[model samples]
Target: MNKSVPANVTIVDHPLVQVKLTQMRRKETISSDFRRLLKEISLLLAYEVTRDLALTEREIETPIERAMFPVLRDREPCFISILRAGNGILDGMMDLLPSARVGHVGLYRDHETLEAVEYYYKVPSDIADREVIVVDPMLATGHTAVAAIERLKKDGAKNLKFLCLLAAPEGIAEFHKGHPDVPVFTASVDKKLNEHGYIVPGLGDAGDRIYGTK
Candidate 1:
């Protein structure tokens, strides 16, 4: 919410987003509740991320009379999820853009090196022609986000945005250094990442919290 935020980042600090983020951050929050809150907060984040979507007028007949309605210029935007954790945000993003085409990129951070290793990736053939939104719940070390974006770019993606639930300053810096053209949207920018590369004051491992795997 601060006007001093970097030009490339938009923090959705709305009351509802903040309230839900608080609930999600608690260690006592159950997996079910955490998952639900992530989805809710993601929906709110989506509203801001898509604020500049292009629209065109279309004539449609209402019950009373015909009228022009504004519809997305491109009916389908590309939604790419950065693996298992990103799937959580993808679910909520889809709720907002049900018709958007979906893509998946699977990458995991190496515990020792904190580097992202890609295992799987598939995207729409027309990704170059559509605006792409990359979803990942936590942007901690940022290797994964950077790697994912690079892969997308290599595959012809041009217009791109990155969305995450929580971000670390280290991660944001690294991300921008690699892809300054892409904008980032997040619910909260936490203090910092610990030595192990986890965001301090972050809601633990987002994938673990959402899936109860840890």
Candidate 2:
């Protein structure tokens, strides 16, 4: 619908993310290692994503002396993992920001219509007051991801971010067209979507790979 996605959308090209992404893409990678690498890469990506988070000074006593130290503002960020595939990224982001609250949103794309249909949705206590990040592995077509963000906005989340391991240009455009105010952070943007809607030269079905299913 809309073609204007944020030019600022970062495709984290860090060498470590690239290396881990390569491992995740291999067909031989087992669920255990897949999950582990996803977690590690997610954490690394989170580090870059949170670089601009607001911080405040707080008085703390170190082993040596008492001084004011910069800490994440008293505010706690909230994370929403789009079910199944998103959970892999969730593990990593959680490991990085243990203090952040968590939520889950589940949606299934209809086999025939290819339309997103929500199955489950749950969020933190007061999402309006906190920064919210939605994690999903692939941003293809952007139908489900955009729908997810619409639900989050309806629920009161003012600040939002979308995190994905890989994204296609078409999907990214669709997403930003709908929510231009929100920013997306992703590991890499592959070439283009094939006729079947899979990203070309892209990692295969993320949900299947992460959970060890077909």
- Which candidate gets the maximum TM-score versus the true structure? 1
Error of 1 at 32 (Å): 0.6
Off by over 4 Å in 1: 1-4
TM-scores for all candidates?
A: 0.97, 0.94
lDDT of 1 by residue, 1-214 (tens): 2234577898988999999999999999999999899888888888888999999999999999999999988757899999899988888888998989999999999998999999999999999999999999999988999999999999999999999998998899999999999999998888888988999889899999999998
lDDT of 2 at 213: 88
For this target, which candidate reaches the highest lDDT against the unseen true structure? 1
TM-score of 1: 0.97
- Quality of model 1 by C-alpha lDDT: 0.91
Give lDDT per model, in order: 0.91, 0.87
Per-residue CA lDDT of model 2 for 58-167, tens digit only, reads: 99999999999999884788989999799999888888889999999999777676678999998987999999999999998788899999999999998899999989
Give model 1 RMSD, 1 decimal.
1.4
Candidate 1, pairs of clashing residues: none
lDDT of 2 at 85: 90
